[model samples]
Target: MQKYLSLLVLACLLAFNASAQQLRLITGTVKDSLRNAGIPNVVVRVKGTDFLTATDAKGNFKLKVPAGAVTVEAIATHFKQKEIMVGASQTTVHITLNLLQPLITDSEKNRYIMDDKKGLSEVVVTGYAAPRIASGIHIKASPQNNTEDYSPINENIFHTATDQPLSTFSIDVDRASYSNVRRFLNNGQMPPADAVRVEEMINYFDYQYKAPTGKDPVAIYTDMAVCPWNTGHQLVRIALKSKQVDTKDLPPSNLVFLIDVSGSMDEENKLPLVKRAFKVLIEQLRPQDKVAIVVYAGAAGVVLPSTGGSEKSKILAAVDELQAGGSTAGGEGIQLAYRIAAEHITKNSNNRVILATDGDFNVGPSSDGELERIITKERQKGIYLSVLGFGMGNYKDNKLEILADKGNGNYAYIDNFEEARRTFVTEFGGTLFTVAKDVKLQVEFNPQFVQSYRLVGYENRLLQNEDFNNDKKDAGDMGVGHTVTALYEIIPTGKNSPVVNWVDPLKYQQAKIMGNQAEVLTVKLRYKEPQEDKSQLLQKVLPYSRQQIEQVPEDFRMTVAVAAFGQLLRNSAFKGTATYEQVLAWAGKARGEDPEGYRAEFIQLVKKAKLLDKE
Candidate 1:
């Protein structure tokens, strides 16, 4: 009886101790400068413990802490970190952190921070975020050179012809505001937003490219129609198709893959997705192809030396062994991969380096100048590079684009498995094979036929007018089956639209008369042979009526809607008459004949976004 009583007493003591060791529940919402607006995916860490939590879709986080005073830290990309001390009895806490200005201000005494009051004056609402003003960075367009072949088919389509060029050009419009709004919506428990990249959104749909019915080098087609918003403008879509090249037809390929296995890439969307994407590419490789894999994180090393494509199991096994950790040494990895590719250089065959990363190069040679120098030097060795960007949140789009541009390669952003398949499998030739390097488009608007114009997208790809004909200046590359599209929004001379008021009148400049009104725009494309430095030009004229081309097919309209949606997400000034509902309608109408069900999936995404907005 005494033993039983003792056992009961011990049990009671254990229960009391367990209950007294209190666990406090804390809850809070993270916000930006204005307050109350939640920030999503903010990383929260407890100072002394390994415990961490990310804000939910609603920007809310809940954590349990031991019964003692502790410090909580919250960090996010582009935003300042917030830290707070919690007392032993404090069960809940709230915090707000403001986004840091990307630009630095020069003060008389020292470089310091400036409020965004003046910056906010430049905001133009285009449906995504609030307006953002220009960053005071001046982007000069190439001067009008009289060289006939070097001139753009139409200046209005490719250049700003108006005095208020900033107002007309979407590239100069505010993007930070749009991005901020998007972050808010995405964190506010809103459904996955349909913020497809303008370029990718348009490129996702397969336009009708004349397939080689008979023997031909390649087949190409283009569709030009009036932009829905502005009847005075047109959108040009180009499609190129190459004859299927089987494994036997493919030349021996020496391939080097440069991968980032940094700690930031620990998420499933980063390293795991990269492995899966590469696996697809491996399956499509020919037996003659040789592949080498290089990884960078704190240090760079060759994980897998040159191996035959036929040895699929061996390559995949090496891939499976990869795990993400450590800081990114992207420069070291690039150098090592280039060395391997140069060592295995094959004459008259495919030699390339493929870079896969989230573009966070924090550990070594992370500066833009250093990275560009490395890539530029490597490109001179007659080896091409391709950049595949993965993951988000901490993504570096600017850096990735620069690398591909200077490396004589192409750039792609993979948001999911479907994009992976599309880039690696469906469009392998364009993604892997290069046809032309340093492709530049320059347009010369005939002052006689046009008034104001703006080029859409390609904000970072602009070049000097002299650079167009320099041949030495590098530009974008074109793959075997790749298609590049550019859009323009125009305001005709006669239109009385009051989009922007000119600060000063150019009364001294005489308005030119229109000799021929038939031609609305002209396009000039210059490209160089992959191995050559000189470029060849292709020119085409689009008529004015084509600018008003209507009754576009549902598929084509859907494609435009996708691009428009992207512009809206970017808060582009050119996004006139493009609404979320309109985008949804177009997507729904074109969700037919989806053999892979990708279109259906996009439709569902749109619906989800709509439902979230209702909520």
Candidate 2:
């Protein structure tokens, strides 16, 4: 027994030594060989294993790998992936990638180079449920962007009307997702499922809802119909119409354009496009408006002193002269821009910092928590932020969304010149001015009418029911001309439906509920004046639907079509039998005059999606 014990100890020691010998520390920097700039957010993974890490702001990465003849692959969006071998003796390595296409390529078309090491890895699919194809996108049951940041979608579940009936969420007016999805489609690729936000897509286009006619700043429009996607389910549309402020009534502006000229922003879709976009905005500014140019790349500094907006040539030249280079130092840039805005801000003035970036906040206050706290603190001083996201691939939507949410602002994704015009030119007042802040909504569904219900597309914007009255909590801000639309799919009582996730009947509550015969829901809205702490309240009671699906209004039909399109892009489990053909048919009929051609453009997008999805 003693001899066997000694042999066992020796065997264990040998095994431990072998394992240690196979492990190695790997370090490297990922860079673009042509430009010789470090690439941040590139995924560094050991093939056939779970070990992974991403390159930092400087494109430097570190990883531990099993050292004997192991393969290391670097993955990045739009950049050609590369693979290299690290032997037992190797201590450090370097990876140089060829950018498939620069952000500012000569051609407007996307030409992503395909290679074995370039496509999304197998790991992406296993995070969620089994893969489901959405359009051309291969969606994993769970989607993790590997190196990039994206907030996960926690699909809301149906709540039994008897168990818990209140549904509340912050109103989201940010229309970033629509243009972001359009970016993918125009590039001939499917957008990541998380990028297709249903509410934003529906809110992007203008609808002919009647504006507020009374003293109220906002009006409510409600409609209901049998859901086209799931016949047994009912779709409820709740929309808000805010009074539009004419340009002449708008207050004088103090604008600071905080531009990112980081190396990653050097592409045609980035810095160059930004200059052009800002030029368009410059053309719209009035003589009373003041504009300042501040840029960041490795460091932050003011490029142009505060100039009167009437000097269009000076502002245009300042923007055109700006060039892209160096590393991203977003936190530093933000501080300087806010400082500039503070100096120029006047009482009742439109003081705002227009942050243009790809959401790469590499240096200082970069993380979500840190940035959120800092930006939130800054907004208390009456300095607002409006984030204009540009470019793709390394785009950090999650981070920019945080900045906008915390900074008392809105966000928009500018994919091209047309979108830039739409956001900066056509919607100038909506883009810059704010009428209401901390807007929140709560709906109390009547137990006598509703069996179960689910709110669509505000997954990330959902708020606690009690938060409706909480004046301290921050919520979405409403722009001067911004309109918000929300939808809920309900299961009526006394109906047999699979979606009605029936729980065991309560043993204690035998009492029946008494409610108004016409009231289906009571929606309450709370909002604060842009400068005030206290909130004002608005309420409206919705009656049971009087219109059938075939007779629904055009706005309702168009909204339904857009919402369905978004769900299809997300591969929503709730979108039962919702086909692209149906989406097309419903949207085509709802196409109004579309003077701006936005609705017409949406119809064309649906056709493109149908072709791409082979539906």
Candidate 3:
């Protein structure tokens, strides 16, 4: 048998009902020996056996070990592996794991150096992550930061604009990636490539796109320009702006705060930050609005029943008194939150469950598929969900991504008090009120003006071309005042760029003749009112006109710059010589308004990322 010399186990016995005689449920909490905080995602299993289970957010586990099993092993990502023995009659045990410092190979040692200027230093993994550097590095990450999961981004390939004239996708208003990436950067680490969503980064700051003037609630804008990286190619920009709604005019809200206070959240950044964030949001609630608080740990329960937002002090007290120290039961919390929302749901109101967590749902129904299925069924009842991410270690980006994407909601990451302010105070209306749902976008390129083209970013937001007109299909949700942007890199016709994929010309027939027109592509948008079944269609035709790169709106160029930065981050196949230097240059020139200073902050981030770029 394999040996683990570090196992430290504690055992205890409790009474059980006679009906439980058929199965012995082994339940316990796992924790780190250093800080005594619960360790998440620890593998818990019967030693030398296939029977196994993993520890949840609070480092808790419940396993149905066979009657004869006595020895169990616990293994965590950055902790020393351990094995512990259970007492003959014990049904519960507590296991603690000692931290394991990674063996520093000569190659790895060369990649990382202590930055005296910063309190904590970045450990650069040459190939897997970005070059990390500088300051507070407060994501408070252990070696476990690198273990978080994110969906791989598959860069779209170029298609002959003639052969595939349609570029269809869902309009994404989710800015989770931008804040998430900022968390890593502020922590002196380059965020994982997949965590950098270009479109979200671009849409993070407000743009000057004109709001809708017609009966439709959304407006579309498009512009084409010479690609900065390769002058031979062109870049197309598309923007969608939703009409702004006055806070007082917005429908009364029915909000449920679904919080995860598992033992993993006991950290300063997790539960503590979450409570403060909810308090900030409480300040924005109107008299007509109602709020409820539901928290989950080893079990789920309501700390505060549905009450008028005017009772702010009572709500704040409930939030302040929350303590974290149990396994996470995310599924139960979600269900209970939905049930609470459903009970007091007001027709036509902004009904939503605001979930704040680190995305470590390790207990029942923890998998993305299971959580998504649960949220999907609940959303049909008219209750939307907004996932607010917190903290870093064991953060499951993919799980939150799926939850927000499938839950008819938006997602945001709360890194610090400032982000919490931005999400709750500055963007209150958009964060809580949805103006349009099932929003979809489709674009058609005139083969005459453009050759092969590739849609930039939106890798996770792409929809099947056929799903565009299908009203039954669930796509994305857009909130009041939200803006969605998409970009396309095109190889203009007759340039014969070698970058595009090749397909043989048809052997049987002649192609359509080109007309002498400046038209490039047309933009089409479909959206339904929050509670409507039918989608309203809106269209705008974009002509192919060469403009002095200087003439394009400053906001348009800024978005372009952000997209380029993302491409550089991902080392995308189509980035074509784009550099962080170029991104900084474009962003600097386009830095216009300073109202919120978001654009200015973005420029600083670019500077930080450039230093972290090994390439």
Could you give candidate 2's per-residue lDDT for residues 1-615 as a string of tens digits? 999999999998997677667667778898866447676656677764434566765778877676577888886543455799887688798999874433222233222212223222211311212122111112221113333445555455567777677898999988999998887777655566667788889899888878787876788887788888877678888999877889999999999999999898999999888998998899999999999999999999999888998898988888888988888889888988988888998878988999999987777657777777767777998888999999875788878888998898888998989989988888888888888888999999887778778898898888888898999988988887778999998878752332232244467765666668678898999988887899999998889874666698888899999999998776564666788889888889988787898888887787777666531
| Model 3 poorest ten-residue lDDT run | 130-139
Indicate the worst ten consecutive residues by lDDT in candidate 2. 133-142
TM-score, each model? 0.66, 0.77, 0.77
Q: Write the per-residue lDDT of candidate 1 for residues 1-615, one digit (tens) a residue.
A: 999999999998887667546555677777766335666656565653433455664568876565688898876543556689988888777888764433334345332332433222111111113212121111111112111010011111223244432221111111111222233344433311222245545555554455545433234344567777555455655444444555466567889989999998899889999999999998988888999999999999999999999999999998989999999999889989999999988776788999999888987788889989988988877887888877656666657767877787766766667667877888777677766667766665544444555665544556766677777787766565555555555545442322122123356555653545566555566667666777776665655545333366655666776677666544343465676787777777766577777566556555544554430
Candidate 1 whole-model C-alpha lDDT, 0 to 1: 0.61
Q: Of 2 and 3, which scores higher on lDDT? A: 2
Q: lDDT of each model, Cα atoms only?
A: 0.61, 0.78, 0.77
Off by over 4 Å in 3: 1-146, 506-516
Error of 3 at 541 (Å): 0.5
Tell me the lDDT of model 3 at 56.
56
What's the TM for model 2?
Answer: 0.77
Q: List the lowest-lDDT window of 10 residues for candidate 1.
A: 146-155
